[model samples]
Target: MGADTITRTNRVTALAPWLLVLPATMAVFALLAVPVGSTLAESFSNPLGVFENYRRFFASDYNRMVVLRSFWIAFATTAIALAAGFFAAYLIAGSGPRTKRILILLSVFPLLTGVVVRSFGWMVILGRNGILNNALIELGLINAPLSLLFNQGAVLVGMVYLFLPLMILSLVGVLETIDQDLYSAAESLGSSPFGVFRQVTFPLALPGMVVGSILVFTGSLATFVTPRLLGGERQMTLATLLHEKAIISFDWEAANTIATIMIVLTALSLVALGMLAKRLSPKGRA
Candidate 1:
């Protein structure tokens, strides 16, 4: 009886973690896995063939253009956000505690508002007679209001703005974790400011950069509201195309196909970035 009781106790202890996580596992299966499985299954459903929808999508010149444009925009947004966010994060990390709190609050304030509201704000600023054009006109920068709205540039601007905070926050979290002693040691060893940053700060911060890049890239690729409002019909992206297929045309097959492609693209990007992160890691260097 004593031996049996001990065995039972050990088994219970081993299963405790699994039991605790069961609710979350079930919720994920029901909410995420089920819907994603349904979408993938529907994407494969076609009277003609399994690959028919995918074939049709890639065969269309317009679809190809939209996919390429989406990738380009995502890449550009990730690049710009990473650069700017890193700088902002470094500044925030080095600031006094009260100033850091204020800066972080300002960074997070934009995220509290809805994407629709933010996109509309951009529209007001970028319109022909908008605040930006008026300011430029007053300064004699141009003869007339330049066309800024409803273009790829507008979309890029909106995307960068929309995702910049996420990147900055990710980088800030990592930057704060870095040991200040390392900087002191480097300086004591006669390392220049840029050298210290290059040899110590950047390598340690690569993980945050990877995380931020993934977030910004995936968010930019999946975003609909900002691109729809800023890019207009002329500068269509994959997300916009998915919306048109699903909502306007009522084409479930095409919409599902587009969604599947997006999922695959996002997954591939994550995997690629993960591998790149490992390669760039300090341990990997040695």
Candidate 2:
């Protein structure tokens, strides 16, 4: 065959598979069409086709509190997880191969326990006469038992412990690719390890940190399991409210409204994070 003809044939073979992805595209659109349609319908409707749903959502203090609590928990968890995960990933990244492997396995520790099982575990350790209290008492750190269960503190601890692995793995993958030669170069040029990390390594790894935080934040925001079991009756996060309204209270309007609010808040958070990431990125032009 002529070389030009052969080249054209090879090019066509490479493009053929991508051309066959039409049905998969259609299926995704089909999957999306239902919920998108339903949400729109619910958002616009009322019991008498009035604007009462939107009004109730905006005016109700309880609903507002639920939304606020959800975001607060999510943001706090994401921030704490990012800080702790970055350091852990740095340690793993700096370690030898065997140690790195062990650290990677340790990253899987959270996955070994189910959310319910983990929540129960937290219940045991954080209860009024919990292990933590007993240890503190034994050490004379506290004069009395501390109430650790059924509140924001318990929720945050569960969340950080639960989703932290994702952040660690994300940062480790990025940090592994970084040039350690850069660190040595900075040190040789009179920069301390801390200075090198602050001025060099961190900016490069910042994108991964942002990604991990976003994932943790979104997951926590959409969380139904942990908060429900851990946060308890007074916590009242949006996800819990959604479940309560949709399933228990059978107020589908309120449930859908809460779901829509969550979607909007998540989208806004991602957009804001993207902007912040861009502003801080060396490669990005302000």
Candidate 3:
């Protein structure tokens, strides 16, 4: 074949995969991109003008507090999930096949239940006349209900419960990928359990931790049903505020602006998280 023919063939081969995925890519674009683009356009085309919705978002004290509160809840949920999930993942990683299967099934059972169902379940357990209050009263622990169902604390509990499985599953995959030989080698080198984990296992698992953190944080940030149900009207996060704006107030422009801000923040967080993961990797350290 001529050089031109060879080059054309090479180009065609390189393009083949893209060709194969083109249909699915177009479907995704239609489903996700179109809606997002429409929302963005609507936000800019509001009566006050292109930047008006965003101006209100930034300039309003209530809007600013909602943004800050959303991030704060997400951060707290991510931290709590990571702390609990790391140990659970380690246990599952080292467990026998049957034990691992059972643990994983149990961990993921909550996901099978709808978020509304789970939130209601929490309400049943945490409400003033709920199970916890009844138990406490019987035990003489307190005379009155502790008011656990309509605050940030309840939201934290619900969010942590919701996202812990993701963290555990992500960490478990990473932990399982670490060669068993590495642990044996560390042990042969007189490393204790703590030393092996701190020096060898943790460094290798940092990527998973980073992945779990991002997932939990983003999930928490965007969750509306749980926060709204559990925190009631007392707490206002971005997601809940967006819901109120779009549904209750019929303020499409404001809602679209909030959605755009969330998408941008989520994208920025993913990039920053990926960079942080690279920095914490063994190769990055070396």
Number of the top-ranking candidate, with lDDT as the measure? 1
Which runs of model 3 end up more than 4 angstroms from their true locations?
1-26, 46-49
Ranking by TM-score: 1, 3, 2
**lDDT of predicted model 2:** 0.86
Model 3, residue 28: C-alpha shift (Å): 2.9
What is residue 182's positional error in candidate 2, in angstroms? 0.7
Encode model 2's per-residue lDDT on 178-263: one tens digit a residue.
99788889999999878998998889898888889889988999988888878887898988888998899898888878877788
Q: On residues 27-60, what C-alpha lDDT tens digit does candidate 1 reach at each position?
A: 9999999998899898888888998889999999
Each model's backbone clash number = 0, 0, 0
Alpha carbon lDDT of each predicted model: 0.93, 0.86, 0.91
* Local error of candidate 3 at residue 12 (angstroms): 15
What lDDT tens digits, residue by residue, belong to model 3 across residues 6-51?
A: 9999999999999999999998899988988898788788677788
Candidate 3 has its poorest 10 consecutive residues by lDDT at 277-286
Error of 2 at 180 (Å): 1.0
Show where candidate 1 strays beyond 4 Å.
1-27
